[model samples]
Target: MSLLVVGSVAYDGIETPFGKVDKILGGSATYISLTSSYFQKNVNLVGVVGKDFSQDDIDLFKSKDIDLQGLQMDESGNTFFWKGKYHYDLNNRDTLDTQLNVFEHFNPKIPESYRDAKFIALGNIEPSLQAKVLEQVNSPDLVVMDTMNFWIEGTLDALKQTLKNVDLLVINDSEARELADEPNLIKSADLIRKMGPDFLIIKKGEHGALLFTDDEIFSAPAYPIVDIFDPTGAGDSFMGGLLGWLSYTNDLSPQNFRRAVIFGSVMASFCVEEFGPDRLRDLTEKEIYDRYREFRELSEIPEVG
Candidate 1:
């Protein structure tokens, strides 16, 4: 099975209590593709970069065995650049600067080879663009889309239109509450399910993640980490891990979905251990599975038999 990811690939300048980096390999698609590459062999990436995006960065994706046929390069423009600083607690962050540049014109064109991708992941981008991706792909088995509050508020019509085609909707708790206009998550999930997707994943950051369907709800706790250096790209990494495992197994059962969320948390926990995708770049299957085991043990509440 193959997976296709459509999102931004750009440069990021990050600052945290640990240290600061002027520019590094970063973007929703970059993190998602890197994390997903660990679980699946064929990961087709679709995004745009500019002349300023270095060849070394392009090589980075190739090194991960990520297919870049759909990756576009705009020689005349600069790559999207974002500068952000994280709070000491690592829960909240402030965006210092954002330059959309080439990404502003990113119109994803799925390569002919990727048109039949079994699984498609639409990273946090405009809902119209996410809908456009679905228009190009041939009957994907699973369609997962991630969004933020920006689109939920500014483009509700387009967001809801895109939702109709998505199999799973992944968004954080705040976005969920705002989207459904309900304070209660369970109620919010119910309202969201009516909008489109059969499944909804409400990410609660370090608190954990929740998965809800029409008939069932599954909760996955976040892996505990004493030191979280940077929280950037954690959510995308989570999505990558979740979709990567599911794409590898080609299983959509609720039980399997529950496991996928745990694996996602596992990957996300590792993401915050270092800045950008440095930690995930060199991760091995053994390490991922070992963490998965820890997650299982942590959540396992044995019955008093």
Candidate 2:
């Protein structure tokens, strides 16, 4: 199953209680594609970067064997850049600066070779842009889209329209609430499902993530780690691990979705242990498998008669 990921690929400056980085490789597509690559090969990436994009980063993508055919290079200006500082709780952040640069005028021109992707992961971006990506690709087996409060507050209508075509919607709990205009998660998920997306995932940050379907709901628990270096890109990494597993197994059963949720949690747990995607890179297959088993153990109390 071919996996196509579309979103921003840019430089990020992050300041957290644990550590800080002035500039590093970071973006929704960057994290999603890299994390997914561990599970699926030939992961296709579509995003724009300026001449400032580093060769090491390019090599990093190639190291994972991620396909970069859809990546665009605009030498006219710098790539998208964002700087933020996280509070002690690591839940809230203050945006210090944002430079869209080439990403501002980004036009997702899917390559002819990538038009037939099997699984599509749309990262957090403008709703209209996400829809444009959908329009360019052929019918994919599964379409997963991630959105944020920004789009919910600004482009609710367009977001809703795009959701109509998406199979799954991945958003934080607050964004889910904001999008559905409901307080309770269960009811909010129902309202959101009615808009579109047979499946809805509400990411609850450190609390874990919830998966909602037409009739079933699965709650995945978070991995406990004392030291969390950076929370940025954790959600995208979860998407990567999730869609990556789905594409790798080509399984869409409700039961399989449960496993995918756990894998998503596993990847997210690793993500916060290091800055950017440092933890995601250099991960061994055995490490992932072992951690997955450990995740299972977290709630696998022996069946009590």
Candidate 3:
């Protein structure tokens, strides 16, 4: 099964308690596609970049064997850049700067070769643009979309329209609450699911993640990561690992969805250990498998009778 990811691929300047990086490859699509490539072989990426986009970063994509046919290079301006400073707690961050640059005028153009993808992951972008991408692709087996508070607040109508077309929606707990206008997370999931997607995932940062459907409500514990460096792309990485596993197995059962959630948590735990996505680059299959087992053991109860 082929996977298509449409979103930003830009540079980020991150400052965290552990350290700082002036510039690193960080974007919704960058982290989503890179971490997904570990499980999904046919990963296709689509986004725009400025001439300032370096060859090293291009090589990084190539190293993972990600298909880049849909990537566009605009010589007119610089790539989108965002700088944020994380609080000492590593759970909150404040944006220092944001330069939309070429991304300001982004209009996704899906290549002909990518039209037949089986899985589609729409990263954080304008809801209208996300809908445009959906219109171009073939009947994808599963469609997962990610959104943020910015779009929820500014483009509520459009976001709700787009949500109707996706199969799953992934957003953090805060975004979930805001989107549903509810204080309780479990209630938020039900409200948001009524907007469109049949499934919803509410990420709780270090606390864990919740999977919600009309028939099932699963809770997966987060991998206990020590020495967290940067939390920048952990959510995206979680989505990637999830869709990556689902695409690899081509399974959509409730039981399998639970496993995918754990795999997602495993990838995310590794993501925060380093700035950007550097840690995901060196992960071995054994490491991922071992971590998945550990997550499974987290909530398992020993027989008492």
Candidate 4:
């Protein structure tokens, strides 16, 4: 199965209680494509970067067999840059700096070769940009999108327009509440479903994730890890796993959907083990399967008399 991921591709400087890195290959598309590559063979990336984007990162994408036909480069500008520091809990982070150089005017242009992608994952970006990308693709089999509070509060109408096109919407607990203007999660999920997207996944960091369909709901618990690390890109990684699993099997059955959520949780558990994308850089299929079995064991229920 082939998958297309559209989002920022840039450099990130991060600090956490575990450690710090000046700059590394970090972006929503970067993490999503890399994580999804484990399940899907042909992962496509669509985003813009500047001259400052490293050759090493490009080579890394090439090594993963990620199609970069839609990855645009602007020689005159610098790549988007973000710097942040995580609090002791590794959950709360403060954006110390943000410079949208090449990304400031990013206009996602899908190459003719990439317009037929079967699965599309729209990372956190302006609703208008997400909508623009959807316009270029030939009706994808599945469209999953991630959004933040910024778009919900600022460009609501555009967000709703974009939502009308996607199959699934992924957001954190707070964003779901804010978007629905409801305090209770069940009510929030119900309200948001009316806006668009028959399927929604409300992510609660460390707690777990909840998947809601028009008729059913599934909750997957988070994998417990003793040593905490950076939480950046974890959500994108989760979406990658979920989409990757579904794309790999081309199945949307309720059972498959439940398993996909587990796969997503497994990928996210590995994402937070290190800063940036370092941990995912060396993940192998055997390691992924091993962790998946462990997750299964964690979620198994015992029979009662």
State the lDDT of candidate 1 residue by residue for 1-305, as single tens digits: 99999998978999999999999989999988999998888999999999888888888889999999999988979999999999998888899999999999899999999999999999999999999999999989999999999999899999999999999999999999999999999999999999989999999987899999768989888888889998989999999999999999999999999989988898899998998888987898899999999999988999997
For all predicted structures, in order, the TM-scores are 0.98, 0.99, 0.98, 0.98
Mark the 10 consecutive residues where model 1 has the least summed lDDT.
213-222
Give per-residue CA lDDT, model 4, range 1-305, as digits (tens): 68999999979999998899999888899989989988998899999999988889999899889899889989879999999999998778999999999999999998888888888999999999999999999979889999999999999999999999988999999999999999999899999988888899999988889999967999888899887688888998999899889999999888898889888888999999998888888899998989889888888899999
The TM-score measured for candidate 3 stands at 0.98
Error of 2 at 194 (Å): 0.5
Candidate 3 displacement at residue 61 in angstroms: 0.8
Candidate 3 Cα errors over 4 Å, as ranges: none
> lDDT of candidate 3 vs native?
0.93
Flag clash pairs in model 2.
Answer: none
Error of 3 at 91 (Å): 1.3
lDDT of 2 by residue, 1-305 (tens): 89999999989999999889999899999999999999999799999999899999999999999999899999999999999999998989999999999999999989999889989999999999999999999889899999999999999899999999999999989998899899998899999999989998999987889999867899888888788889999999999999999999999999999999888888889998899888988999998999999988887769778
List lDDT for all candidates, in order.
Answer: 0.93, 0.93, 0.93, 0.91
Q: Give lDDT: candidate 4, residue 20.
A: 90
